[model samples]
Target: MSEFETTGPERAGPERRPRVCVVGSGWRFTGGLSHYTCRLAGALADRSEVSALLMRRLLPRALYPGRARVGVKTAALDYDERVDVFDGVDWYWLPSLFGALRRLRRNRPDTVVFQWWTGTVAHTYLVLAAAARARGARVVVEFHEVQDTGEIRIPFVAAYTRRVLGALLRRSDAFLVHSEHDRQLLGDLFDLSGRPVTVVPHGPFDHYAVTHRPSPDGVFRLLFFGLIRPYKGLDVLIDAFHRLAPEEVSSFHLTVVGETWEGCTEPIEKIEASPYRDRITLVNRYVSDEEAKAHFAEADALVLPYRRSSASGPLHIAMSNGLPVVLSAVGGLVEAVGEYAGAVLVEPEDVPGLADGLRKARAAAGTRYPDPHTWQRNVEAILGRSAAAAEGGTR
Candidate 1:
């Protein structure tokens, strides 16, 4: 209610529903951020007055790898017409900031939900959030990750990124996190002893699910999904694939799906060049939704032995397809794997442990996500009167 509130009928009667503006990576046809923006915005539109302000490029061409633009070229806007989309935020252009801000001022949404994941877009978001706060709109930051999960080899670069994320968190009025680990991390990183941070689980990626299919021949297929990054432990998984017993290695085919970013696939390619080359299939590109669905449908299990992560969408995607997951015990993964019926959790980078987990996959059952996280509950926790009960969830 700072400076953005209009006193009378402007805030009531015909437009009684809460006006929500979601600004983030839009229409990414194959990735997590785009998937999240589309799903959450569509759900919000059902109960609230919602519109999405999406960025055309998350990073410059030089910065992004394996793709020309961030999103896919689909005929429909944001994969659905129900959710209103303003699909023109070019991060490279400074003028785009003013345009987005002008739209915010003219439209004046009650809540401006800015998606925060990487520190690269911090400066732009900081200015935008400040303007929204000045205009009296409550700014709710949905943190996918407090810091970028992409492996940063440079020490100085990593340090600066953390500082930028801390600044952005300070600017936001309330926070919407997906897990308790993220909620605790937010409190420890900033001075939020009793802040309004609602912990809403990520909705099931049920949209990605397809009818299950048996593996090719007799070989068990293991899928290591998502972008190739150092932190995701792809190298470790590849090494484990080679180190497996001859009979064990012969029993399975590893499907390494996803694009290699910033020239990070050398190690994976090296492993593929080894004798295990015949056993591992490296798909180095962004996959279409239909392609992704087919991969999940046939795969025996999804392995994500991440070095670090706040929460996981790939895990949810696997569960949605009723696929058993074999992930490392790190971040919110401990809590996430527990919700699934037949997931195998091992120590991060534990090569032998991961290898053994893969061997155990033959006996694993297709998991059941009995209670999927609903978007209705997520939006309500952010805007309804029950929001007060979701607060004070801090260390």
Candidate 2:
């Protein structure tokens, strides 16, 4: 029998849900995109017949920044049981790629949603996009960033990406972005004159907030979490911490928890040389969900001083926990957290402004129940009729 010939028990609904295939990084690679892939698949399952085709191996071990833990089981998140998942395609393995193509045909999805972050998967995406289109499926590419900072630094890679992404975007039927800022960047970089582009808010990463507990210590704890890369502006955060008055510094403690990436060591060096080093705790490694939960639980506020970003996973984690956040206003981050009651936006790279924001965050430190973002709204915006009918190409 053909794969599509087999039918499961009928679900109670007004009509049969559309079948969807979500393509993204798998848990084997274990990063923000992997988490987002799983979460999105699970959410889509609530309203669609969902299948996930994940990238198991993105690149060669030597070239990967997180090579040491490439295949390690570091994530606690998994896909919904209702969603069919293929653990996935590899960058260099032709057999794995063939298997993914076969899976796509077997699933016969109505729409294939591709997660765009790095150029490493462009070839694979182009191949899969063609396969999906051949099967009469609409293709939707969700833009995570215009171009990866690390990838943009390499001239050849940048050139290759420009050609490949241009082709892929031309073939795509629709586009999804996290914010209007991202929509503008997409328009500026590519020609989307008649394409349907919808702005969807990032869903809450609240699954880890079950471990929330207030700090027993009297000190007001501040956290700066996520990968420590050059673009993350960790050095500016260090400088902001130092600018705090002696009395204010005495009342606060800063925790820097993240895996070092792209050899960005200046922030760590600054931390080691600081006069108030005793007040800072640094966990310079990628941590498990349980460990991350513990970090959020003991913290009074979360601070992310990014020089540039489309969106942030850590910021969503803070919002889910209702933890007060002090974020640098840049890129899509400003609109992403602007409405949150506990958010204090400061100018990017402004050390004094960050210091002021930190003070404000400390003064307003307390849990605010009910996170604003939801997966249901995100799902609706991506597949709903309004998204298809959006005006002037993007909404």
Candidate 3:
């Protein structure tokens, strides 16, 4: 409880729920973290008094890759009704920050959880964390990735992030991550001598699984979905598709769906120049929820050949929909989907390995994988409760 607890009526009930405030990027940015914040707030509301403090503006539109579609509603997810929301603090707006502080002061949550994914919100998070700690609220920073791969590529932003993250982490009471790999990476990357770190698996992003509709053209459909980044290894998949046998290439169709980022257009160029150009479909833009649902529904399997990763929302989407997944074995991915019934793990950057995995996915096409993850388990871990207690055993 640390200094966050006060003997009051709110804590007097036999089944008193912890008051928690989850802070993260708002839907205006509309990506993985946005979905996660909404989903997490909903799950936490089941057993805790919850509030969502979101950052409406992540950065200037010119710098964001998907700036053209910023603020467009692309997801079909929202916060739980029981969870109060403050739709958020902006980069240059001092009033928004003050308003967020006021929300914290008024609600007085017992726990303040910050979803850490980028350096853009580091300064704002520091201010909120300091305010929360001063008022006796326990702070938790959940690590989605040690650092954003795109941001880390820049020398100056990376240095600033390193310093700001150190100070922010020093103020936190505990830490939460998606896997043991991430837990080890966090400790190795930061100074967490006395703080606790809990590994809570990422919950399913099943909201996109609206229906099942495999390709009616009789060709095997393979999907590569998400933001197009260099580290995601989309080029490797493109190369592997080209290397397939003529018969296999003729019978297979590859759908590359997602907006380009970090000036990554090599894969797109390769797809355009490939011999089997007609076999590949490139959306080359951010998609709406309906579009995503259609893509997932029509695909035979989902493929993620990330050179490195922490945890992936697309992987969970496939699992939720029972679609076969062909992904690279790297970072937290091995622990995340290795045991799944429909997962085929390939070595990162290996063209032949990926091609083989693709063939395997095609063979298992039309089969579905049962969803194995639950928000209940994720909620219990964040609140530091046992699975038995979450499932109705004595707390």
lDDT (CA) for every model shown? 0.72, 0.85, 0.86
Model 2 / residue 221 / CA error / Å: 0.5
TM-score for each predicted model, relative to the true structure: 0.87, 0.94, 0.94
**What's each prediction's clash count?**
2, 0, 0
Better of 1 and 3 by lDDT: 3
Off by over 4 Å in 3: 1-15, 387-395
Model 2, span 172-202: residue lDDT tens? 8878888888998898899986776787778
How well is each residue in 1-395 modelled by candidate 1, as lDDT tens digits?
32222232345235487777887775542358777877888877777777777776566656666556445553122445765677656667567766787788776777778887766666667777788778777778888888775534567767887776667667676778877888888778788545467776677677876787886587788999888877788888887787787777787888988877766876567665878788888887777767778788878889998898877777888877777788899987776656566688889999999888887776674444453456665666655535434322322
In model 1, what lDDT does residue 46 have? 79
After superposing all C-alphas onto the true structure, candidate 2 shows an RMSD in angstroms of 4.5
> Which predicted model would earn the best lDDT?
3
Which residue segments of model 1 deviate by more than 4 Å?
A: 1-15, 28-30, 67-79, 150-164, 365-371, 388-395
- Residue 76, model 1: Cα distance from true site in angstroms: 8.5
Looking at model 2, report the run of 10 residues with the lowest lDDT sum.
Answer: 2-11
lDDT of 3 by residue, 252-333 (tens): 9999999999999999999999999999999999998889888988888999999999999889988999988999999998
